[model samples]
Target chain A: MAVLQILEYPDPILKQLSKEVTNFNSSLETFLKDFIETLNSHKYCVGLAAPQTGNLQRIIGIDISRARKPHLNNGLLILINPKILEVSDFKIVREGCLSIPDFTANVKRAMHIVVAYQNAKGEAKILSTKDFEAHAIQHEIDHLDGVLFLDKISNPASDLFRRVRY
Target chain B: MNESKNYFAVFVLGTDSPGIVADISKALFELGANINDSSHTIIGNQFAMLLLISTEPVYNTETIQNAFQIVTQKRGLTVYTHQLRHEDVYRKSSEPGQLCVIHLYGADKPGIVYQVTSLLAKNSVNITDLSTRRFGSESKPIYIMYLEAEVPNNIDTRKLGSDLNKLALSLNVEIKYELEEVASL
Candidate 1:
């Protein structure tokens, strides 16, 4: 397993839509291991997407259990070509990203979501999540679509805040 | 000239009028003064502005003040300029804490701001930004206050909420507090 460098904002790769992960083989497994390793390298980072590491594939890693308040999390999650089937219970919450450091903004997201994805073994899996887990999943999915939290801010003047260094 | 000693805080206040920003900005631009940060807003019939500016050491507070003399005379504006201390040139970074917003509204009354802010200050809660607005008719005005603060993690927000509830009841107002959840991804 290797920890890959996370691409920061203004990187053209981050703005490109990730392609679907069609070949689920040893290469995919190796990439997944590196993805998990990269995520674990950061403190309090709950989720990550393939595009964040310059990989143009629809792969995301999420483990909200690492979050400060892991409300309704299901340990580690590896999703390939993930899609949101249903969503409800919308709420506005502040969000920050590794790609865009030192800034946080309020973004509206679904509190509950039903999603379908493929596992590392190429088997199809579906899950319904709520609260923090759901929020993390949604954020990672946005990365696959070349979207960032800054694009989702409702009011730039008031909702955006400068994050304090830890 | 000491390039490091060229920072100043400028304040401008005047009746609301067109071209105020354009005129002021043009004057500063001609003087090669860079506006590092500025906030301008209209309150009722008055336009208020606060600016942090930096220029070449050759330009002092008096130099910048003289540049605005034309606008001051033409627009009848009040202007103040003060050289900033080295320490004051940069804002202190905020401490790591949970960000929260407190919203309060009720019939207009005296001591509302004093009472609420005093309680917050006593509890060690740092107020980051706050604004109050008066609405409705003059005979029956309503006061609404929105405040953003950094709350220490050690403090129980539920307890703070309860205390605010009690304060609201005593003051005949409504108070709501919510933590600004920051999702890390």
Candidate 2:
């Protein structure tokens, strides 16, 4: 497993917005692979975004393959320029971030979503998902827009919990 | 950056009145003691102040306590100063595993949280966060307690859910458990 350096909180790169990928090429492929490698290295991490790693490109990798129940092993998806087309009902879920590694906060998110984006093959597609899948997608998308979960936290008092694992 | 210094806690109690905070803070500033953390609140007819202070070059708690003797005699207040060792500081990471919210609401009664959490603790579950609130009328008031706990891997929630279901029936209180998943970024 490749051990990539993780960016911590208050890092300028983590706050910078990502640029949309216009073309699917070998460089994009390599970045996607490295992203997967870095994510796997963090056993506790379920996903990663491009801006977080200083790429500044609109790319995100998520592998909820091992998630509970039968889930789509999409393994890795490279969304060049994904946009949310539809969202249904807000759902509250506690979320932990790799950037803010030691803290967990409750966040309200879309229960279901339909996203439009371009695939690695340069083909455009739309995908719909709910539950954890939808939540993960929305989180990565927020990172692409320079938004952290701390930004999306609905109620600061109800949402944020300090890491005090003893 | 300067060298790390030790901290102390000062306890001050006097009759409920204004100017307590100003008076205490003024003394600390004059003594060159930094207030790292503090909780000053009035409970009942008395005002209680607990100050977590730090001093460079480490000052004596007795010195500070003695300095407050004049205020104590003047206002009939009780003042105490205590030094804290490194062991006194509690710093640790939060609980791991799946953190879930448990909401219990029922008629005003004792031992609601006791019975529910007693079972959870017996099963090795840890409570990371908790809060409670009371509402409704006095004659028919409702006691509502909200608790957030972490579920360890060994304990599958299905079993806990079933057990809680049985307890809900016995206690006649509504209990709800919801998973709190960490979202990736």
Candidate 3:
């Protein structure tokens, strides 16, 4: 398994809408291996979308357990062709992206969400998540639709803060 | 004079009115200047703006000042320009640190800014941006301060919080702060 390069913003590919995953073939298996490796390579990185790695496929890897502070999560999640079935109330949370790397914005996201997705084996699964995990899920799902947190900021001048890289 | 662009720090202030930004930007654009960073806000009917502009090596601070002469005369705005050294352009810290946002509000009084900033300075906390406003009834004014700062890795955050609490008590103000966590997704 190898760590794939995360494409930063201004790269036209990052804005391209990711395609749905249809075939769970050997190539998909190989890509998943590299994707998981890349996700686990960074410290405190909880989630990564397929488009971030320049793969225009509807897939994301999330593991809030890897964060510095303890957060209630589903341990490690590899979601493919993920779809948000339902959502709850909105809350503001400061979010930063690996691709953007320069600024963090207070993005309004659903506090609770119901998601339907497929696993590595192409088996359908539904996950009901809340809090930080739900926020991560929404962020990753947006990547599949070519939407970045910058687009969802409540107030551009006030809510956006310069990111101090750690 | 060699080949690199010249950077200038430009400050503009005047009575708040429409067309301030349009006139200023048009001047800069005609001068072939690129605004690298800028922020403008209205404070109590006064329009204040700060801009970091870069021009070709041929232009200098004087050139920028001369370009704004029309706007200054027409709108009665005060404009100042100072050239900046190249080394100061990109001074990002090599070592990363924790980012913190501090919010403080209380009755209007002097020394509020001094007391809090002094405490932050003693702790090696670098203030990145700060804005303070006075509001509420004229008889009972309320002062609010919002600050964004970078805390060095060497500092103890827990102790800092307690210190701030003590300062809040002494100053008789409500102070709340949170360390910004960037969920790297």
Error of 1 at A73 (Å): 1.1
Per-residue lDDT for A1-166 in model 1, tens only? Answer: 7899999999989888999988988898888889999999998899999999999999999988887654678999999999999999999887889999867888888999999999998899999999888988999999999999878886655777767767
* Candidate 1 residue-wise lDDT at A108: 86
State which candidate has the highest DockQ: 3
Error of 2 at B135 (Å): 2.2
Q: What is each candidate's fraction of native interface contacts (fnat)?
A: 0.68, 0.74, 0.60
Lowest lDDT block of 10, candidate 2 chain A? A66-75
Cα lDDT tens digits, model 1, B1-185, are 23465898999999999999999999999999898778888999999998989998887888999999999999999999999977677545555567788999999899999999998887789887899999999999999999988887778888888888899999999999888557789
Which candidate's TM-score is highest? 3
Winner of 1 and 2 under DockQ: 1
For model 3, residues A40-65, the per-residue Cα lDDT tens digits are: 99888999999999999999999999
**Could you tell me which 10 consecutive residues in candidate 1 chain B have the lowest summed lDDT?**
B88-97
Where does candidate 2 clash, by residue pair?
A95-B183, A163-B93, A163-B94, A164-B93, A164-B94, A165-B93, A165-B94
lDDT of 2 by residue, B58-133 (tens): 5788878876766677678899888887656434634466777889888968778788899899778888767777
Predicted complex 2: DockQ: 0.45
Arranged by lDDT, best first = 3, 1, 2
Model 2, chain B: what is the TM-score?
0.66
Chain B TM-score for the candidates in order: 0.91, 0.66, 0.93
Worst 10 residues of 3 chain B by lDDT: B88-97
